[model samples]
Target: MLDLERRLRGSKQRLLFIALASVCILIVLLNIGVLSDAPGIKSTIIKVPLRGDRPYDTIPFPTSDGSDFEGSYQPEDAHPIAGLMKEADEKWRKYEESRSKTFRETVAKYREKHGRHPPPGFKEWYKFARERNVHNIDDFEQIMDDLRPFWAIDPKVIRKMAAKLQENPDDGIAGIHIRDNKVVNLTNPSWRSETLAGLISRFVKYLPDMDIAVNRLDQSRVVVPFEDLQELLATEQGSRKMKSDARDGFTKNMGHFLNFEEPTGDWDNETNPEWFPYPGRQYMDIAKLACPPESPARNENLTVEDADALYKHQLGGLVTNFNLSTDLCTVGPAIQDQHGFLYSASSMIASKRLVPVFSECKVNVNNDILFPANMYILKDPRYVYDKTYDYEWEDKADTLIWRGVTSGGVQVEDNWQRMHRQRLVMLTNSTLMSDQEVKILTESFEEKGKYENFSHFEPSVFAKKHFDVGFTDAWGCIPGDCPFYKDIWTFKEAVTLSEQFKDKFLVDVDGHSFSGRWRAFLFSKSLGIKATIFREWHDSRLFAWRHFIPLDNRYDDLYSIMTYLIGTGFKTNPADNYANNNNVYVRKHDFEGKMIAMQGRNWAQRVLRDEDIEIYMLRLLLEYGRIIDDNRDEIGYSGDGSELDDFDKKHPMPESPPHLNWNTI
Candidate 1:
């Protein structure tokens, strides 16, 4: 009987050992993301050794909770954002393959694209592209998108319009004059004109003497009506008639680029002056005129209350197609009140008239030519990442950070809360000083396995642990409206750019225009979570989800995106040692987040270098030269491969400025 008892005791000890081993393995798997995290993944069975036949036995385990709230957020396994990395990788691969590697290949591709011989100075531009290692030579389609429309109008008429717009401070347009292989004049005394002249002076030697008008306001200038744009596009298409003898190289233009001639007329810069200072009047009174009759901006009418609901439905819980979401024509006209750029943009000098005007950025509703913003070109210290604070992904705090002013628009009493910057601060600051509960996706309580559930978290505590977001000040609101913003919200002291570099993820939302600090954020090692409706010059070079994370302008997806990256912090769960214990396991995505961060950081260095900008400008100038030339049809580049060898000997590039100081400009 004693021997029998000993045998039973020994068997019990073995079973206990097995049980302890299984628990340890489970913890390891859960922490490593092997057990959960991805959508449609994470197993529900544990293998145990069997006494008979098979070496192991499969023990059934509970899956995620099948509750309503659990299904709403990012669940364990099979989430939409899980596949974004692979998608971005494949897209980048395809984009690289699409671009021409050799100069001859670029020339060959251009003929197929434009159906004509290369433009004048095309050979010199190619050499510059090769020397500078420009990532994008073939994709200057934005220049085409803006310049193509002007092809429908008489070149002389376009030139006249350009002259009238230039040197007009009331029009908020700056004139840049390039002559004798140098920049000679920059009309308008704004710093923008000076900085632009400095940017153009880098390669003015390769460019034909030309007049360029740049819009100085944060708002876009041209808003071509939909019917007019369609007709213009058709005419532009006809202008690119393919030449049978079109081949390699370029031909010098017999006709010279003419000086901008002012048209004889009284110019009215402020035709609609009374509309000023009214929030959302730009979209209602002006921008929607660009949308087609069938488009939602023109067709669908919704009150402010209905707009949010409809916008969310139209935009899914997460953003998959960043480009498609920014289509102003697709969304309801209610965006007029929702977006600051649409509502209270600095557009006192906005025009429905089509002109060859350049801007830093514009929405799909505007037709302004896009150029690289000087804010990026200048690289101010305030916007630059502090190298002293930069850390590796594993070493960095797993938090998302954002800091900015309330400068989206001039906020009034009624509409201050609707501005994107204000809304972002409020949402991120939820529950911090109050009992407000915000929904967060974290491991479930009472669940046997690791599964994310849409759980409620105390705002102050939760946001403090995961997010460092707030405004430095409330700057753009009207006098009466401004004081309350300070009262209701806690204004945190502004943190430097380098301070944000310590975090794993950084949020970048639009200001009055594209964020001046975008280039700096991209330069950092952290994930750049960008949310904007405005389109910039380098949109074609980078892929969303791969290089950076894209958020909807509505900001509904902000929390979900954050959860997918750093994870919801520890919460009370049944799996803990005891009930109500705050020891729930949450998934951290360092590997995934770092993968995207490195991809963006590396690609930014590759394609968005200062040299790359100069290369893009040179190519664009060559195209612009062709567009404005009187002998546009006859002017072409016909250089063979031999010219590339003797490029410098044939046409020497001008020496760049020794130093460019932004503060002085």
Candidate 2:
């Protein structure tokens, strides 16, 4: 009996040992899997701030003329817009879940094929894929979701928002509210889910007159608790920083602001608002709450008058927010204030009280007349002083210089507007200018080899057209009378004309669109002889003789203008003016011309600075905010905060200065 009991006890001990071993092995395996999946969690979370500082403090709202609000305002009860964002959030969540599944599968496949585990995190996958020349490892479009957060205001919704308002219906202005950057509540320990209505309600408390606010709240929300997104955000941030640095370096070295590096960030892939890229970049570049530079930061508040005055400077227009206009008849009209002027960079409703810049077109979407309203006017990367050339009036080369491809339109027999370029190209010898060598840099070219059908004509076809009859058809002057290339030299190179700053005469002509190079030419310290009919953002501010020497749309006066400059009639004193009835306008001599060049440089330096732009943007926001508030009843916005509804009603837009009449030109 004793022997049998001892054997039974030994069997029980063996079974217990086996069970303990199995449990221990299971725990180890689970831990290994978790560690592999979330190797980047800590790094990613640490970079994100839980709460950010509030953008602005409560201040008295101002009217269009930059005065305190005297009109009565009744604050609306809090009606949360969080429900509006439900669909967006749900779609994002589903995508996150599906993305994780596919990502895991990809990682598994990589490991199985290599006979070893790949890098522990998906962020590393980018580098791995690049090393292997694999582009299809991940669905890039899925990563950058197209369904944005802000819903467009439809007629029904507009009525709802308008009905919510209590005061000022008939004369109120209606504009879109786009929260380019999502505001966050950093004080909360964890990201608290909030709605669009909730966010706007909180924002309007600081500026009550605001009619509507639109934006995607995802950036302000908590990140999904998944390894894949955490990895993507981290990777994207790193990649963006690297690319931004590279672009900054290029711009700085070249002494010009242009985004040469193609945007590789996920945001660039999304179909954003018309004014997304420009203001989005501006907001990100300067993350601080924009206000007047001289105002006290915390101790004192900026009065509406004070803020308005700062933007009243010549460059103040640059300070305004993106104007949102929906039609063409209401574009490019200016509203002056104590500080400067206000114009919509985007779409705004047609109102008699406001001015328009570019009238919107519903039928012909590609109307060459419409300015690329979405493009930011400030220098690309960031505004900076260009002291690269010291071209004194006497020392500058006598030749007139211009270089660019025919992008405005194809110079075919039917397209007369495009003929202007063909006329210029005829001057350049045919043997030197080949098919593939010089042609329009279209949307396809801008995308490099990724997209197609961006140009007006193929390179070979374009060359043939220009060489055959397009040039002759466009140039109205006879062979010898044409004066194709005397002192003027036009060529094509993969570079900006800033390289030719040493030339005495810089010819500024209208391209397929607005002349982006005009700003650069203004700073080149050389005499800019221009012939552009395209009205741009700063058209009202430009004085005929002061900013540049004007030439009529046709080149009829081209030879005569050149003769006045290079001939013995060229005088040094601004007082001694040279005249030619054949020329559209009288030319200023060397001394006065130098002063004008200096003035142009000074204006460019003052108005086009980084801080100048920021001030203009903030002031514009305040102005638009007031416009929304004053007309809320008409536009269907409701909700309350009368304490925040301060306005300036005394001084409206100041008496306008004599602006260059575009119609007459």
Candidate 3:
């Protein structure tokens, strides 16, 4: 009887264990989207997105054959052209008249229909309409004037001037137009418009040119390529000596506004460079504290809405990463060392001088990190597309495409940011990827040449456990010859062989610091899938879905998210079809997705042009000039510096002071 009781007790224990194990398995399955319908859930199994375009559909993805784009703006402020400001003012007046008339008619119609005029701010109801549909007077004149400076003599006028010059090329100083019998035949002329507004606008355009010329001249004076600066940065004593020299005259020359002092901390590995007036950790903590309540760091397992929220916060929170100062140019918090010397880089805020770089937990700065237009499009300007892509929607492959180097991941001892690259490799090699939605071209960590230094990377370790990942050959420089540049370091070569960018979807992930090809992706006219944890100069201007799809940095969510997007008409209709795994059986055309792509392309083409770059650089120079001009007295420079004379000796007015009493003007 006792033996029988023991057997019964053991059987009961075994039954309980089985029940618990089944429950746990069910929970795991649900979390992994085996049964969950929660949006953007990852499927344990991988598959391709539904192809909505027809085989013979002639819907060409709007493209251009790389003509009509122009190069950098040339310096042409030799002479000011006439009537530009007057022309601009007259244009504004006409627009105001037309708009006022239309607004009056609208108000009358609204009163008749609703018994009251439209609420306040009705005229400004559509803010984007003016920027999108109608170019403002200022914008129109700026572009036109820059492209064809009014001072550029007409072809007929040029011929007359040439004829006069030929009569006596060396002796004759004949003016293009008769001016009081005086030749006034100088190569560089003065501004023609007398209006203060016009004069300022015209003067501002040339400041950038002058700034560039001066910088070039200064660069020539340096003995070696950043040699002195490099040595100073490498050692503490050299840095201190350089600081002492700056205090002697150069600091005063720039109108030293703040008192100088030596840094009060050990120059350790954890500290920022001496040029930065404070430690990096201080500002980094401030950024974290200033994170808005809606930041994604507040929660996990986020949805698309959460991602959008994070993007907005990042766009606005850039200011929190710097020290507080009413003066925009203040470099950092002050120290109390009166004997210390002042240097511009030390006195100017780091963010103002350089864009911040993120490699794992550390932050660095790089001023040379401009958009790749200079390196790529400048090399072959004809390659720029007037529209977006070079293929039709139906002809383009539906796969998600990416190609880059395995850079940061291998340097685990130095950089933690490389995990994103590793995660990408794993997704491409997943055994469950029967449809192969993701097509990546990159060297594997085990590759013999480039990534041989990297340690072993198992896809399953970085990705979901059920992926059943497999090994794939490292595609180190297989296709050969980068179409972009000669010295293509990463990817070993351009991975344009598969025509990957021409694919329906493009993935842009961060490299060592930031994604260099993000702007290209923005203008690609493909569904841009951006996955990063860094903020760029264009952050505030970007909008998710309207601009590009924002993917989480963790990258695990990409597979599930892409599945959701392609299956649900790119989220236009989230309920179009429901599936247990990443596969979608139902195929529906995603017209809205195409529209989003077009919008993104249009925005990039409009704002990221060479003309736009010129304008940005010009504005920055103007601001710096203003600061220097404001403190000219303390700087002890007469208006006779050779550099000033080179740029027409046109000194910018003080930006601040004396509240401009009307009578003073």
Identify the candidate with maximal lDDT.
1
After superposition, the stretches of candidate 2 with alpha carbons farther than 4 Å from their true spots are: 1-385, 410-418, 424-491, 568-588, 630-665
lDDT tens per residue, model 1, 236-288 = 87877545444333333322233445333544442221212333465656666
Would you list the C-alpha lDDT of every candidate in the order shown?
0.66, 0.31, 0.32
Which segments of candidate 1 are over 4 A away from where they belong? 1-76, 242-285, 301-316, 332-334, 432-460, 569-586, 638-665
Rank order by lDDT, top first?
1, 3, 2
Candidate 3 clash total? 3
For model 1, state the Cα shift of residue 352 in Å. 1.0
Better TM-score candidate (1, 2): 1
Per-residue lDDT tens digits for candidate 3, residues 345-456, read 1111222211111111111112222221232224233334333344544445555666665432222222212245545644554443333343111122243112111112
TM-score of each: 0.77, 0.33, 0.38
Task: Write down the lDDT that model 3 would get.
Answer: 0.32
- True-structure Cα RMSD, model 3: 25.6
**How do the candidates rank by TM-score, highest first?**
1, 3, 2
Worst lDDT 10-window in candidate 2: 335-344
- Best TM-score goes to which candidate? 1
- Scored against the true structure, residue 251 in model 2 reaches a CA lDDT of 9
How do the residues 423-539 of candidate 2 rate in per-residue lDDT, one tens digit apiece?
Answer: 445433343343323211111223321212112222232223222211212123223233543333333344235556666667765444345567667766776766543444344
